[model samples]
Target chain A: MKRVNILLGGPKSEYPDELSKSIKGIPGPWVGADRGSLYLLEQGIIPDIAIGDFDSINKKEQRLLKDNIADFKKFPPEKDDTDSELCLLAAREKYNAQEYYVYGATGGRIDHFLVNLFLPFDPRFLDFYDKLYYKSATNTIRFCKPGRYKIYHENGMKYIAFVNLGPVTHLNIYDAKYKLKDFNAGHPVSWASNEFLNETIDFGFESGIVAIIQSKD
Target chain B: MKRVNILLGGPKSEYPDELSKSIKGIPGPWVGADRGSLYLLEQGIIPDIAIGDFDSINKKEQRLLKDNIADFKKFPPEKDDTDSELCLLAAREKYNAQEYYVYGATGGRIDHFLVNLFLPFDPRFLDFYDKLYYKSATNTIRFCKPGRYKIYHENGMKYIAFVNLGPVTHLNIYDAKYKLKDFNAGHPVSWASNEFLNETIDFGFESGIVAIIQSKD
Candidate 1:
């Protein structure tokens, strides 16, 4: 299975220290969205594809990105999709990766965060909902369709949350500190701050998408 | 109309400079949740009530809260509801305010943020959905039920977003940079980064709740 990592234009402080190590260890293409290209360049890593409107970067940074990155796609500032969405679409179409790790998508404007978080709900990206994973300094978020799944606890992640992004039915959770069975929700709800009972936990839902977020305090 | 502001344990950096001014200008009572009680005290504003598990603050700070606040409600750390929820519940039952402004509830753990954002969906808080407002440094978020509403532009807010928290029908947007007419959404979707055409814009939905977010870049 192919894996690709895309970075957006969120605050630098939100990036985990392990991001650089992961970039070096993972053998996959790196796509930079808007100012994220400048961020990657600052880290001494040239992105495989730099895509965005380039509004956030200065002239010198844009020149640097153009000089170093071979594939740079620039769009107009006034566009329908956000820079992050455009970059994700480009990565999806070009790489067709089975898995996508998104960085720099959180800890910024609430609207931007919401747009990124609900991207999978859009018709253009709905099919790949399960493939997208959002990573920040303190959290890792994943979306799941209606199905049974086992989740392994991460080393430092103390809390796990199951949030229904829409209407959901018959949700079941097992082997967790707080267990739920045959739950139904009419709208978005976050059952947050749950802990794992063991190394792994099991959960399933009958319908709707569930966002499973693992985070530290 | 009575208005009460609730502050949560989110990071202090997310608080706007105008927070203190608003806290002073508004005459309504203030409620602090967990470490937020300490934050309120740091601002030299004595909260009317402090409610939480008191896990995030030191013993000294807890003592300060106990000493200063008239109503102090402490719960065990391992409780069903979060500190923010507990505080809101207490405020709702006691004050029965018509409007609520939430601060220090953004820019922290993603799970906590999600939990706070989706609080209106909880059955306990569902009746007062329209009464809640979340404020951060760069954003003001409000929820609305099925009704027509006129939104006047805030002085510094540059963009407006309409987000369907659930399945929405017959959503209409008028006098905005990007207008929508009778649009229906099957799931949660963020129509973000839209601008206003004039001093006020109009929007309405036939069904479901919509979150209108006004933000600055």
Candidate 2:
């Protein structure tokens, strides 16, 4: 399986201390979106492909990137698709990768962060929801469909929450510190701040999509 | 009209440059949640009421707050309602405030931010959705029920976006740079990055809750 990771151009203020250790050596090629290319270079990991408008970075950095990076595709700044979306498209078309891990999509402007949450709604990216993920040092967000899923306990994030992406029915949560019986959520309710009591967490829903956000304070 | 502004203890990393000027003398009593009280004190503003667990602040600071502030409510750390919720309740019950402007709700843990987004879902808060707002330096988030509304343009935030809090039908947008006719959104899709062309934006939806976020980069 070909796996790809995407780096966005979000603010550097909220980068958790553990990000470097968590992504030090993963199993795939990296793609940079906008200022993420500069971030990737700073982290001593050169991306295989760089995509974005390059508006956030200055001309000096852009020159340096063009001179060093072998494959760089720049788009007009006013284009319809965000740089993050273009990066995913490049990853799929060029690398043929269906699985992706995303970084730098949070901790900046709320509008930008919120838009990233809805990227899976696009018709082109609909089928890849289960495989798409947004990760940071303290949090991991995954989109899920109606199905049974088991999540292993991890030391990094202490709390697991289910946020409704749409109206959900017969939602069941089990084996956690705070367990819930079959419940229905009509809106994008936050089933928040649940701790993992055992080694694994088992959860399922009869219908509707959800985004599971596992995080630590 | 009794208007109260609530400040939370969320991260200060993304505070916009124009926040100070924008909120200089807004007519309202200020309330703080947790460390937000200390933040307000630092800014030379004494909160009318401070509400939180007080775990995030040191003992000396807590003592100082007790010595200065007349009304302070401390809750057990393990409570059902978050500090933000307690502060809002106080604003309503004690101050009889139906309108509120919130700060320090964004740019923190995803779980915390996500919970702030769902505050209006509670039955007690249903009627206060339009009057309740979460305003950060870069973004202003407001919840609204199904109805026709007009949003005036503000200097601090140039872009307006609509996100579905629930399934919305017959949504329409007008007098904006990027206009939309009657449309339906089944999921929490982000209709983001729309610019305001005229002095106001007119929009309406037939059913369900929606959140409007106006922001600037």
Candidate 3:
């Protein structure tokens, strides 16, 4: 299975250190968005493709990106989609990977974080919902459709949360530290700060999208 | 009109310094959630009521909270509502304030942040939608219903974003740096990082809740 990793320009503190340390171990190509390209280069990893408006970086950084990256796509700063969204679009058009791991998509400005969090809920990006996994230093977020899911614990991630992006119905969670049954939520709700019982958690929902977030302090 | 301020247990860096300086100026009582009570005391402001599970604090901190705060309501760590939610509930029950200013809510664990951001959308707390104001050091977030409204720019907040909490239709933005008209969003979309042209902005929507967030870098 093909896997693609896309990095966006979020706070450096939120970036997972393991991703930088094991860049060669991860499968598929690396796509960088805006300043993320500079970050990849700083880590001595050359991105396969660099895409963004290039507004955040200085002229020196821009020159570095242009000289180093073979495939670079720059758009006007005034655009419809965010730089992160544009990277995802470029990844879809170019790589079309089955699994898309997103880094530097969380933290910093609340507005930016909100956009990244809800990008999957947008109709334009709904197809990428199940495929996308948003990973940060402290959290791993993924979207799920209506179905039963058996989730295994990620190393060092102790807290599990199920957030309803929209109205959801008949949500049931079993074999977890906290269990909910036949819960019908009318609006967006974050059932946050839950924990895994042993190594796995079983959960299912009848309708609407649920964002499963596994996080650690 | 009665106004209340709620402080949650988020990162100290995210808290606005102005809030600490102007604690005397803000009207009504103060409510602190869990470690937030300690934060309030550290800021030299005594909360009128403190409500939470108190799991995040140590024995010394708990003793300090009990000694400093007069009205303290503690619950078991394993409870239905989060500490932040519990504080809001207590505020509603005790004060029934028209306006609620929430601090120490953003910039933390994604799950915890998500829960705080979506708390206004819950059915139980929907009544506080228009009244709740989430304020961090760099951002101010407010919720609005489907209506034509004029938004005045907050001091030092340069960027304004309209985030659709759910499905929204006929959304229009006027007199802003970036403009949108009659946009139909089927799901959550954060039209983020838009700038302000003047002192005020004109915006309207036909349906669904919209979160207007103003932030500065």
* Candidate 2 lDDT over residue span B33-99, tens digit each: 9988887777778888989999878999999888778898989987877787788777877666667
TM-score per prediction, in order, is 0.95, 0.91, 0.92
Candidate 1's C-alpha runs over 4 A off are A20-27, B20-27
Q: Which structure among the candidates has the greatest lDDT?
A: 1
lDDT of 3 by residue, B123-180 (tens): 7887777888999988999999899999999998878999988778999998899999
Model 1 C-alpha lDDT versus the unseen true structure = 0.87
Chain A accuracy of model 3 expressed as TM-score: 0.95
Residue A53 displacement in candidate 3 (angstroms): 1.5
Q: Which consecutive 10 residues in model 2 chain A have the weakest lDDT in total?
A: A14-23
Interface RMSD of each: 1.2, 1.5, 1.6
Error (Å) of candidate 2 at residue A51 is 1.9
Q: Clashing residue pairs in candidate 3, if any?
A: none
Q: lDDT per model, in order?
A: 0.87, 0.80, 0.86
Off by over 4 Å in 3: A19-28, B19-28
Q: B-chain TM-score, every candidate?
A: 0.95, 0.91, 0.94
Q: What range of 10 consecutive residues in model 3 chain B has the weakest lDDT sum?
A: B17-26
